[model samples]
Target: MIVDSHCHLNYGSMTEDMDGVMQRAREAGVGTMLAINARLSEYDEVLAIANAHDNVWCTVGSHPHEAEKEPGITAEQLIELAKPEKVVGIGESGLDYFYEHAPRDLQKANFLAHIAASRETGLPLVVHARDADEDTAVIMKEEMDRGAYPAVIHCFTASRALAEACLDMGCYISISGIVTFKSATDLQETVKIIPRDRLLIETDAPYLAPVPKRGKPNEPSYVKYTAEFLSHLLDWDYDDLARTTTDNFFTLFSKTRRP
Candidate 1:
């Protein structure tokens, strides 16, 4: 069975037809899903979705895009909110220089708070890194020196140097459908060298649907396409790729139970 390690089930299209979405995911061999919370304000909706589905789990924390909204959000607040059994990870948070929706300083401060919560709670930090690899790497390394915390770089599309740096720090790299694009040759090559045990796959659904599903609204079930592409790219059996990524998901998000 496959696991869509990151998705936004609370968003419009999927939320309106959650039952249908869950059914489709099951039919697609998706055994479990991690419903990511991109904003603290939406935690209830995200958590409710997870609470309603036994195979679904959620995370707590703001995205870099929403950093300015919650710049003062502290690790203590995140730790308190994450006490819920359904909340399995922290922060789809990190630097997103590509969009720059939030100020860089605010984003960094917010990212560090999420890191602290992850360290304290021992939950994997679901990181969203884009075009800020240097600062992201430096912050991660600095924090790792303070105390070790589990993390996964979700939807990674940075340089090979960043991938290698993250891997060196024992962090897992999650590839999205972006790796299947023709223009992503660099990312594709980087993905090939990622250790199997440290590799993961996500749809980041409602966004980045893989080829064939490209340009359409993405969903958790579409993660299979990303997995299928990787099986070919990495030259592993399809089932084996599914199993490896699913195992890696549970390993990093240890708070979630295998369904």
Candidate 2:
């Protein structure tokens, strides 16, 4: 079975037909999903979804876009919020220079807070980095100097340099449907170099749906297309790719049990 390591179940059309979304996912062989949290204010909603679905788990923290609004969010606060059994990770956080929705300083501060919470709790940090790889790498390296923590770079589309940095830091890299695009040659090349054991896959649903489903709203079921694309890209069997990525998911998010 495949695992959608990152998604927002509380967002978009999926929320309108929760049962259909999950049923389709099951039909497509998706057995597990992580409902990511983007803001502390929405943590309860995110947790509720995870709580309601035995196969679904969640994280606790703010996204870089919501950094300014949750300016005072602390490592302690994230740690406290993560007490729920269903809250299996800490973040969807990091730098997002591409959008710059929040000030860089504020984003960095919030990102560090998340790192600290991850460090303290041993929950994996669901890092969201875009066009800010250098700072993301530096900050993570600096934080690692203090203490080690598990992490995964979700929806990764960064440069080879950043990929190497994250892999060197012992963090997992999650590939999204972006790699299936013909225009994603660079990303595809990068994927070829990622060690199988360190690789993970996500749909980032209600967002980057893979080709064929490109124009339609994305959902967990569509993650199969990504697995199929990667299987051909990596010259591995589809079943192997699915099992490998699913195993990697549970390894990083150790707090979660396979459904």
Q: What TM-score would you give candidate 2 relative to the actual structure?
A: 0.99
Compose the digit string of candidate 1's lDDT tens values, residues 1-53: 99999999988699789889999999999999999999999999999999999
Q: 1-259, model 2: which lDDT tens digit per residue?
A: 9999999999999999999999999999999999999988999999999999999999998999998888977899999999999999999999999988999999999999999999999999999999998999999999998999999999999999999999999999999999999899999999987999999999999899999799789999999999999999999999999999999999999999987
Q: Which ten residues in a row have the lowest lDDT in candidate 1?
A: 10-19
Backbone clash numbers for all candidates listed: 0, 0
lDDT leader: 2
Instruction: Tell me the spans in candidate 1 whose CA falls farther than 4 Å from its real position.
Output: none
Candidate 1 is scored at a TM of 0.99
Superposing every Cα of model 2 onto the true structure, what RMSD results?
A: 0.6
Residue 83, model 1: Cα distance from true site in angstroms = 0.4
